[model samples]
Target: MIEFKLPETRYALNSDVSVAYQVTGDGPIDLIVVPGFISHIEFQHELPGYTAFLRRLASFARVVTFDKRGQGMSDRMSGAPTLEERMDDVRAVMDTIGSERAALIGFSEGGCMSILFAATYPDRVSHLILTGCFSRSADRLSEEAWEARLEQILRLWGTGELTKSIAPSEAVDPAVIAQYAKWERLASSPGALRTLLRLNRQIDVTAILPTLQVPTLVLHSKADLQVPVALGRKLAAAIAGVRYIEYPIGDHAVWTSNNETVPGDIEEFVTGRRDHGLLEFERVLTTVLFTDIIDSTRNATAMGDERWVRLLGEHDQIAREMVSKHRGNLVKSTGDGVLATFDGPGRAVRCALAFGSAAKQIGLSVRAGLHTGEIEMRGSDVGGVAVHAAARVMSHCGSDEVLVSRVVTDLVAGAGLKFAERGSHELKGLPGKWDLFAASG
Candidate 1:
């Protein structure tokens, strides 16, 4: 289902240090991604929706993202990088890519750097965009309290504890937490992060905001935990001709969830136009389906990385077809499988069975689970109790079998679909015991 190809990574030399960067797409506009606190340019694609998000941006412009110096693929340093050094790295990357002028999409800590870059090189920046970014490090925190906050980062540096605050829903899944933990370890070590924190404490771009010469846009989620929306509002208020947009949902990693409109918003801002049809985001009752390839890790190991990746592509192709055949929205792919939503329970149940059969034909086994409940739609991503319930139901499934919650069976009562009682069981992470059933023809 992913259409964009991964860009080849290359290094830009800033004197002796090598800064790793990638370029994707061939549109007229060149867009640079200023990554946030934690980043592993290579491992980032492994995260859910990240690659797709980049591809979406690629559709409009040539996208460029690099590991900030001392983070990800960039050369590891003994000390934290200063704003001047980071800016030099950016210019070096721009020169290597032959990009004369480009829009900068700065996220989190990257926002501070972007602000500095835009102010320093007015001739080279086409537009300025900041999301989930803060202009000041203190963020209204008192000196004592701010120090405590910085210390807490040290305490949980490599534990993936940040996921709990930035992505609460995904944090519940052990696999997601483990992935984030590994990313933390790869991005920077505890000692290096400590050094960075000491330097970050002094960051304050408020004084330079009004002097920015390029067009700017500021976006924030009212509920962003990592960078409060208040800081975002303050940043926008200081800019002379800036546009600010706030969403009802909050997640620091807006590209991953909730703010599905983010890409479209960026598109409109940069291009002066946008796709009229954005995914409808609203709360509604629907049948949510979850499918997982059985023993995916083991299978990946046995098949080897390259072959396994090809197989996943095949699986995704079939899954997408089946969802469309059943008139369901394929919300997103879950690495080995997919999460989808359907208007009717019967079609979702049938699609699961059909997709399962198709998987076996390719020498793969898949288990599916379905539940009908109220789901909160955040653009293209779906979340809420119903979504989690469906994943839990799938976890209880056997190889190649299709399972459904009692709610699903009840909804499809007279649709001619038969379900065998699987009895009551506790769905992990959800309160209370619930009856589960196996769907059959």
Candidate 2:
């Protein structure tokens, strides 16, 4: 038997609320491991799987793990809590240990919270590692599906086999599953779990996604039942600078079920040797275009399935041709909209106006918005507040209209592209108001 000594735990953060945490190991780099849902620092080492995982992590850096507020050894406060509060809990833990910055390793739903923290406080994070996570809860499951899962949790409470069912891969070992159940029971109260689930459902970090600037690694199993692999890909696609890796089918608990592969990938990503996931293009000047089909749903209904399919085929071809002609990259189609990037804002603006004109001739009207900024070009897409701002600008335009921000206007001032001031408008998910204008013939 390998004897593991428990580290001295402590608490910090003088704000009306404080958080509990523990630190262990004597490595050079500090690594903070945030729990997925329920965790207890005292009980974790007793379990072989959890113990091995932490020990392996500690091999490379000093490891810190903590019980989140309202769970484990932390103070259980009354009333429901928000994700921001949970992030603040993480901040409190770091402050308690006098750690100015550390690599964050977050698991399951904890991955989402980690992403939020990295984006909101990039400077404080040396590196970010997310496992079995998603960008937003809305993208995780359908409303009916989410409701059904919540009902199951309510009915099962502590004795329910919900954990085993949700994580079938971990069910192979009875001892491990039993240990997990025991930890879950001891880590959090039923009411706290319910509230956490509710907060998970309401959490949305899609708007702030592009703001993430630190080195990021996203790892997910193809067989994750709680959160699908598609959600992981979506998150990687939305963030400007991130690396994504997919493991063969396994449970959401990467440490236990897929321990063989998880640690190796994490080690490589952190050391900067293998950037095998998505490529991160940072601070490159580029033109961004946001286009959406006007009244697309109504048109689909009017044209019926057959004709609508034909029209969409034509629409795609036309857009692709125009993009290729201008040396632009057709990122990906967003079902009802298309996102493309260009080398110059002038050409991007021209492409947008021409696309709108071309669509109008085919009885299909399109609206587009253009902006130029230092964008992070990730594999197959662009990201940053500039992209979000461009999307918001598109939301304000009518069919066959092309809108541009003042920054883009300045970039293409001498390009002979005419413009009409649409005045300033407050954009959703963006800070402050923006001065927008419409392109004219």
Candidate 3:
């Protein structure tokens, strides 16, 4: 029999709304664990698996778990709150604890909010740990799949049937499954659950990720049914300098089942036992390329559905091949455009030039922008003011043209990639003025 000594649960810093949390252990480092959908700090310790996981984490650091705003002990609002608002609740809990900085451990939907926090408030975080997370809600599951899942939640979430849909496996102990369903019902109202799910579907943090400067560890079960593992991989790739660990557990709730392994990985990541393999340089240099199709919407509408799909496939193949030829990594596809990264500014410039020239033959024109600067690497993508600057530069150019920032010019001075200065321009969302130039033919 496991005798769990439960910690005293308390409320912290009441805004118009207050957040509820519990503090346990007396380790040197402060660790804050954000809940997924429904969490009650007081009730959590009663579950054997949940209790064991927390105790394990507490061995290395003081653990803090909190109910998110509008759920559990926190005040319930009339409407669904934004991810930013939920993050404020997390901040409130931290402030209450007098924590200068803490390692953030977020599970499931909590993982998305955690990423946003670490990116938005790098100074407040010592490290970030995300499990089963996605950069955007749209990318996690397809539209049809999302609708189906939502329907299941709405129909069965509180009916003691939610566990049937989420158990680690069919062989899971019935007692354990019933315990989870009970917690789900106790921790949140149906309205609150629906609202949280809505927010999860609409959340997008792809743009803000590159600005994150803290050490990050991303973990996801390769066999997770709720959130696909590819989304996790995409998240890791989008953020520069992120360490990703893939586990084989199919459960979305890691601490509940297959409990030991999940918490152990988190403990290792938080305690510095695992080297995140981050390098320190005064300035890290990388090339940024932004490519957009010419008259994309018009082309899609004109070509109709079938023909347009075929054309886009051809365009994707061409762009991918050209990007690969120049040793560029395809960061992501932005609707009709593609964003890529290169090791050398010169290669990026040449790739953009070649891509633009080749695109015209296919009745397409690509606008590109290149810059080199110290970039914060999240798993697969490069980010920071530099990445945004490159995107802004791309916006100013016309179809079939490639532009380069002055920083890129300095890096590839004798690379034979000629450029004609476009002079200074004020870019939106960027501080100060920037010097821009057009790539020469």
Candidate 4:
């Protein structure tokens, strides 16, 4: 099941304008998703397919999504935002989140912005994924034809009339059309869309294509009606060492036609592995341990900085020793705590108990949570829903307490690891209620 929740939206200031943005997940890589034409941040999750698409992306990386100036929940502007201005908005969002580098995933018109951002700020971009994108708007339509199209859009705006143009495959479905209409209405007013579209047609990032210094992946549908597949091919050909893939489907919308196709392709390109085991990624049933010192801020205040630092150092060393003693891999330290992975749930349980004992000896109260589940191995890091579940399990813990999910209790049934039933709780951003137990032994 997908982790379902409306991510809390925050604002990133670009000059005086507030760019609405949201960040989700905690994977090693950071991804910034730039939306096409218009978007409503919260309204996006209302559609099941779109939510699933985002959840799939969030499964592998920390995703940062935002609304540009004069669009959805962001500050309204007087005129259409130029590529440079929109690029500033993306940078602002990244800066707000302290993201030094991120992979840019841009869809449709946003793809043009992504290209400009990647080309202009090569130092900040690690990888680029552009879907149904074009480098030169002039190649797609003549001036007269473009003007005529703009007029048509103005006339049919907000009435779900562009469903066929947007996603021809879903045009016949009334429910889909109705939902798209509502999304369009919430995305922007007719006047705003016209201005954005006019500006979008003026975008020509062809000159910067050769200057891109990062790996790029270009995806397009063969039967896309809005932008021809040839445009997508030309875009890929301009960039150095860019991988291009064209699907057989006809829809221009990224989340529709083949929902899994887009995310699956992206997953393979970015991580070198498809979701269904196409590449080198490994899946192992392992135990995850999350621990943190209780009331660390208060403790630090009472002990003072020098003494606190010394005690914290000792605490980390003890954690390392205990994890090693239990044959666990020290994934990383969380400043006030540590996250480790173990081969056996029983050993993991023993390690948590040892941590509590060790912390008490050092006059530190540490709480821990453990869960056994399959995890996606990403080089030295790990991800997937299990890690998120483990984190939520940790949040439910109290001072000097070691808690674990039911999976851990079941796995260590005969290992003599004692657990007191803690009942079930609904984990934040995760699906369903999970039964938890306190690791007493």
Candidate 5:
């Protein structure tokens, strides 16, 4: 395993607050990365491809990353930072680094701030790059829709739901989702994030788009869920002579999936050289596991809303822990169940069995199913025939039974696990009959 050495953290005073910053590499060109709504410089490095993504850029530039005021290692703030305050934070970091001018890589909400900063202080910015950015938050959704969205986000803030929603492919692995959940919690409190999102809707930079004098590059994904591809197009259209590249596929984040592509593109855009080849997408073979709570609706109805909500929270927490413990990825909690993936079919079955045992301690009856196949990564989510097959196997499961498909059984043969014939069953929406089995230690 390649060890990643985290850049030494330094403090840059952003007014009364100390904005935490880290610098990597020492190339001629200086680059400042503007973070989105949530950022934790330390926690972010834990994610796969993120460090490599930075390393790719660092190969040609001096890269600086920081946690904005009120987030991550930076001092907390009582309220969201306005664009002016954000600009001040940037200036503070630059001043600390003794950088006269630098290129800017803005992501999501940070893109809005970067645009304003570049336009306001053109002399200070060498180049402007926006990734998965939108021109106006309000333009993306109606007021009612935005409110509902904010509510939904806050409701699931620390539960790693963002990965499922924004990056489904990553959600297929429980480890990624679990780490992301920790990152989310460390990035900001639920209340702080709520404040930030509320003010985000008020951001309107469309009027300033044409007036920008700095050279700009707009990189967006065609299938980004958070900031729609259409909005990204409109954002690019408003800018003057902006070099825009809408990738054929990706989600909100650029650090994973086809991560190296962006850095190579940035290298070319800023330095007039393309030195890296395209990295083929990461289709992987793994076991998909599905766990469902037996009679979940009945349990919820009998428990009532308040009690059921608390109980569900416990169940979800336990589910996440078990998935992580067994080296599985918890994709998302299905209200009464969870979808996860494991590299080994045996581990997948063992996780389900362990989870089932855990759930019973809390008076919950859970069943699980497993199948092994080649799965495609859709953003952070995983899908393919294997996922559906696993779900179908679980649907046919008896109460407290860990069921699996023949694919799973075949993969784990002679691995010290045993299974009983569950009979031939026709899975809905899938062609052909499937032979199922009841899995046991």
Candidate 6:
């Protein structure tokens, strides 16, 4: 492991507020990590997960993280800073570090500020990454629910019990719970958190998502207790050409559960490649294929349980064989079919075609769709907008049909592939009408 000397914490003035920040590494890329709700630059280094996340980022880019106004070492004002004021703090940090432009990463509540910054100053952001985030505060909780929650937060602002809600994975450990309690106390005063929460309810940046020109990656936990996966999907859909990845677990804190994977994903996005070896779960840019046995429900009803199970097993085996033959990874069995990924769109398309033909040999017809994008590798399963988009495309296809997105069509240009336009159709839960194509040969 390469040793990194801790960088000195510094401050950037955003008018009356002094935002505390730290900058580390000298990688070619300039990346800024925006915090959620509260942060303390010095205190963060005490937590192993937080430290590991920072070092991993420093390994590939000159990383910058700061305490937003009214938190940590920054000036604690009488009230919370609005979205535009928060944007000024980001600009001040960039100016302090002499970073004319950089990639912005927003986690949780920080995502809202990042979105506002990126849309307001497109030329200053090369890319944007959001994790466990939401565009509208109301989407997270109802006003009545939020008011009740706020009352509770006020009653137990620094009791460390909130750790159970924010970082349930670490709440069980007494030492972790104690540290979180102290960390919360030092992160901000009770008065600040109250003001911030009240202002947070007014945040709604959904309108700006569509205007963002910078490339983006939106990641959310499938089981996130605070921010639902649906909200993250909504965020990605609103942004043109945005990539979305869903982590399997629900920990909202980036420093828990799959903390390491978070930075690795950011590295791949900004650096264009991963520095580590292949693992069961790691974010990577690839093509995803979704296939399902057509009329499986009806067939299962007619075949009886025992025979249906046997046929399903056989179908799974055939799908695995086809995926392996085409150099694809069978991510998981989707009951009636399977989901797989390939390093290239051509291979993914070919694998889908093979699955369709091979399934027909066993008196089964399959529908499949292929799409290319960056995906989050979660142990044995995969989740991302590409995965969902492929499934949507597959759902639109008929028996024995292999369909693909425009991204796939463009990538497999000369791979002896032929596609017929299926016309532009609206994919459920996704923004805009997607132009789809069916693989004719």
Best by TM-score: 1
Task: Enumerate residue pairs that collide in model 4.
Answer: none
TM-score of each: 0.66, 0.59, 0.59, 0.62, 0.64, 0.62
Candidate achieving higher lDDT, 2 or 4 = 4
**What's the C-alpha lDDT at position 19 in model 1?**
97
- lDDT string for model 2 (44-106, tens) is 665544655665566666889887777787887786556788889888888777788988988
Estimate the lDDT of model 1: 0.87
lDDT for each residue of candidate 4 in 23-76, tens digit (9 for 90 to 100): 876777899999888888878765435665676677788888888898888999
For candidate 5, lDDT tens digit of each residue in 100-198? 999999999899999999999999999999999988989888888988988999998888888975676678777778888999999999999988888
Point out the worst 10-residue segment of candidate 6 by lDDT: 276-285
* Residue 224's lDDT in candidate 2: 86
Clashes of each: 0, 0, 13, 0, 11, 0
Residue-level lDDT of model 1, residues 78-149, one tens digit each, is 998998888898999999999999999999888999999999999999999999999998775789987897
Measured over all alpha carbons after superposition, the RMSD of each candidate to the real structure, in angstroms, is: 15.6, 23.0, 22.2, 18.8, 13.5, 18.3
Instruction: List, residue by residue over 298-338, the lDDT tens digit for candidate 3.
Output: 98998899998887787788889888776568988887888
Model 5, position 362, has a per-residue lDDT of 87
> How do all the candidates rank in terms of TM-score, highest first?
1, 5, 4, 6, 3, 2
Q: Considering only N, C-alpha and C atoms within 3 Å, which residue pairs clash in candidate 2?
A: none
Candidate lDDT scores, in order, read: 0.87, 0.78, 0.78, 0.85, 0.87, 0.85
Model 3 TM-score is 0.59
- For lDDT, candidate 4 versus 5, the one ahead is 5
What value of lDDT does candidate 3 attain over all alpha carbons?
A: 0.78
